[model samples]
Target: MAITDKFSSKQIFKFLPIVAIIIAGINAYYTVNEGHVGVIKRFGEAKDQQPPGLHFKIPFIETVEMIEVRTRKNAEKMASSTKEQMPVTIEVSVNWTVEKEAALDLFKRYGGLSQFEQRILDPRFRSATKDTIPQFEAEQLIQDRASAIQGIERRLTEEMAGFPVIVDNIQIENIILPAKYISSIEIKQTEKNLAAAEEHKLERQRFKAMQAVNTADAEAQSILKVAEADAQAILLKGRAEAQAIEAKAKALKNNPLIVKLTEAQAWDGKLPATMLGSGTMPIMDLRNSQEKGN
Candidate 1:
């Protein structure tokens, strides 16, 4: 029995080194996934960075921590006051990622990603939003919303420059104001619209009045033109009648017989009841006088 025990003990001693090596190998090597970075630490101090894929470390002396370096999105709802002291709720989305070159410093300072966010990112974001709000009024915040959003984003980028993380994007999702303020603004806008409508109506009335004045002036001009034409026609007709009378007087002066002949032509065949002059009546019919003598 002693000889069998001695053989078994030698065999166990020969396999013990192999078992120890196997255990050390299992603990020495680790794998980092794509889009992740490994921070190797020695004696609780960050010593080196490891890229993705398989990496080895000293067993029992070195440790590895994986941090996601890819971009991540965080949404926050923050409250702030505008320049006009109007309280507002702002919904913002931030896309950020760890700077690969600053990863070690980041890990050393904050210990972990969650700690970094809690201690640095969230506070800085809140501060930037709060600081930006006071620069604009409540009405401007609602009216020039896109400008306000851009301002907030620019301020956030400036604030985050001191951190080890890069802010990829900042989006202001919404700005919500009080219901009473909105209602007041709507009422003011309605009043403005009514005033504009009244002004337009007055302008239309003025235009119509101008049109009526122009029409009246045109009609008066037409009537004046017609009156002038009628006056010209009457003057021309009077001149023509006077010319005919003057021509007849000239003919009577040249030949006195024309007057007697004109009188004879104008008589109707009836004898005058009494003679006004003691001269011969040129218009008397000689045949009638002869018949009366016989």
Candidate 2:
């Protein structure tokens, strides 16, 4: 019975190679998904990269590492100082993707995404941000954040020139300033707004005053024109009256009978009941008296 058991164990050992071969075959086939590349390594040495598809490898001796080629986002927060030596906390997010052709090389150099981020991406990002942030003062960084973000992005791109990763975009998520400084800025802004409002009010009052002056000038001019017109009319009326008086005096000199005729027209044809000592007698017209005297 022991001989038979030993023989059976030897037989199982002989089939072990077939089972191993079956397992190797099963592990040889790997599918690289979309937006991913498979980095092939043989005997622990990087060979090349394969595109998205089913791929075969020599199973116990060859290995494949799936590398994502799609864009990915990473965020990091760091503490830095401005040119004015003001401390700030900066949060930045980056969009990045590995270069497909350099996948094997990237894998060989940094092993994987986690290792690459630790060794290259995170450190370079922090370095670039720190290097660029100190170039601007705290106020300038706050006032012109676009310029600060551009500077950091440019520096980071430059730092990643020879690396196998493409930086699609970098955004400065937040820049936290000191609470005291923010309060001071708010106070200053409030004062500035108040001053501007006061200036505007003064300007409005000045404009109203100017309008009033103009209206008064216009009214004065209108009154002066009316007075001048009235005076001219009065002068013309007086001249016309004087002219009539002079003509009437000339008529009276030319014809004295006009006075007797006017007096006859004004009389009531009644004799005075009593005559005063200085009163002149009203003469009565006698049509035939002149003929009688002649």
- Give all TM-scores, in the order shown: 0.60, 0.72
How would you encode candidate 2's per-residue C-alpha lDDT over 171-255 as one tens digit per residue?
8889999999999989999999999999999999999999999999999999999999999999999999999999989998999
TM-score of 1: 0.60
Q: How many residue pairs clash in each candidate?
A: 0, 0
Prediction 1 global C-alpha lDDT: 0.88
Cα lDDT of model 1 by residue, 1-294, tens digit: 999999999999999999999989899999999888899999999988888899899998999988889998888898889898888998888899998877888888899799988888888888887888778998888788777767777888898888888885677788899999999999999999999999999999999999999999999999999999999999999999999999999999999999899999999998875545666754444666788999
How accurate locally is residue 156 in candidate 2, as Cα lDDT from 0 to 100? Answer: 91
TM-score of 2: 0.72
Among these predictions, the greatest TM-score belongs to 2
Worst 10-residue lDDT window, candidate 1: 276-285
For all predictions, the C-alpha RMSD in Å is 6.5, 6.7
